[model samples]
Target: MCGSTVERFFRGISEFIFHTKLGVADVQLVDYVSDLMLRFVRVDSLYSLRQSDGMRTKHVVQMISEAERRIGLAKREVYRHVGDFTLFWSGMYPESLSAKKNRGESPDQLIDYCRQGKRAYAIAAEIEGGADRPSSELIHRMSEHFEMCAYGLREVRRHWEEDDDSNGLLTW
Candidate 1:
């Protein structure tokens, strides 16, 4: 299969694993994806801007557009993964547990939720690596994805903190 297609397939598998009953393995996947997403965003931003400068002569506007699309798609995927993970964790605790009612679920449950989310992230990172065009298009998409991931991560972190401390910020 083509690199892009292969990447997509792997990404889908990762998403599946995250949504499934995977365990701590998913956390490792998320960490991997997070690092890759950051790297792709940085590299793609610089690359796309540089390539855009020569678009007049290279007539590569289409390429740039495609790259932007890829970035947008990737970003959305990452956001969804993070959001889902946050929600899952939030469901395990109370919005305002009294000291007597604050026992909450075990740490293992929280870890499992995080692991599944991370697995989904790993898939996205793998697909992001499929862009071999090395043009401005790829860079633009990476930058977009990076921004989305950043936002999603913050949201996820907030949810985790609120859930753990019964702050109600992440309550549904």
Candidate 2:
């Protein structure tokens, strides 16, 4: 049987079209909520979180896990610069990320956020490489994916700012 579109979106890099759809929206909300929930004292596993609409629960977990795995697979060893966009690998982050951690954000929080962005850029590059032929459209789509990762980063930044546990790390 064929994989779900969202699964293909994660696993089948070449064919993954970055469409603004229900999967993207739901994953954003779910991830954002998960980020927020993580700030609290941990009491349960992510899979144990209450499933209001239980139907898609398994799919959500599977999707995230697969994406994370794919991101790891797609991660690059050397820093790649595409035009003005400089993409960093998992262990190596950008200066902006360092500034965030230095300002007051928890290292863990910023690390996770950077990793997410890395995943986005890596997947975008993978798709572009797998394309039949290079086109401006492909570049545009990759840039859009990169921007989506930035958007997610901003969300996590806000979450970090609001946490009561944040001590001196509140330099805005």
Candidate 3:
């Protein structure tokens, strides 16, 4: 699907699951999660952060390490990416964890995505401070309700899977 088509699809499903089904009325939270799904549709966006050698950082631990090595806005962005990465995987494609383990992917196999994701968001929120009040608040809400968001995404996955027309639209 094209960018606008994918965005519309995710936005519609996210609205249905989060607002109607889950009873979550936080519009910003719903929009953030939907935007996350839309962004992750592209393989490049899924692992957009690069390492020193120019490799896309694939592991949560590695991303965290990279985040720690930076400061200020860069650090905050990296931590935010870590949160987004963990949330996307654990919420949408949890079954892929075991596959990653079988492939000898490190750290993530032994760690909790929810924990890391929540902590990462918290750090991002703290780093945000008064410079961006709205963004910080949204990130704080994300940290406080990471599990709910993750559960909502899982519901989204289920909803799509059960739809007759879903077919290959969820290949990501």
Candidate 4:
């Protein structure tokens, strides 16, 4: 495997932030909370790459696979920080969709372990229902996935603003 391809998600996120001026202005502030920010940024970048209009060459399949893989990995990392809604919907909003479960660590909490990367193909299976699903339906589900990711990014924005108390908003 190409080392650069293996690192595409992180590099893509940095590139996206640099080009779009969407990154935090001060390195110190962002680095102070790198653990919380990295997963949120990586997943957002992966999905943004997926929705890109770039022409698919022979290697495009790998990019899609990488996006799906990174999404799962990000979800897992986020799960370690908080239960429910690794991809969104469960805890991103002003209110919980249901009574909150026991609060896990919030994103601002620090950790020292590297998480395993994964793919969401099985998760997709749950949403897609079966192999015979129509192309349009799959496309719709993919779009929903993107929207949920946007919410996930928004949640990150909220956490950044209330770093010490992010769990308070999330626990609602």
Model 3 per-residue lDDT tens digits across residues 1-172: 4457779899999999999999999999999999999889898999999998899899898899999999988888898898889899989998897787777757677888889999999999888645543398899899999999999999998899877365655654
Instruction: Give the alpha carbon lDDT tens digit for every residue of 60-131 in model 2.
Output: 223333344443223221111211122221212345546655876433333444344444444544543343
Error of 4 at 58 (Å): 17
- Clash count for candidate 3 is 0
lDDT of each: 0.37, 0.34, 0.88, 0.33
RMSD of 4: 17.3
The best candidate in terms of TM-score: 3
TM-score of model 2 relative to the true fold?
A: 0.24
Q: How well does candidate 3 score on lDDT at residue 123?
A: 94
Model 1 lDDT tens row, 23-109: 324443344334333333343321332223453211123322333444555543433333233323232222322222345443222
The TM-score of predicted model 4 comes to 0.20
Q: Which candidate comes out best when scored by lDDT?
A: 3
RMSD of 2: 15.4
Q: Which residue runs does candidate 4 get wrong by more than 4 Å?
A: 1-61, 65-139, 142-148, 160-172
Error of 4 at 27 (Å): 37
TM-score of candidate 3 against the unseen true structure: 0.88
The RMSD of every model to the true structure, in order and in angstroms, is 17.2, 15.4, 3.2, 17.3
> If scored against the real structure, what TM-score would every candidate get?
0.21, 0.24, 0.88, 0.20
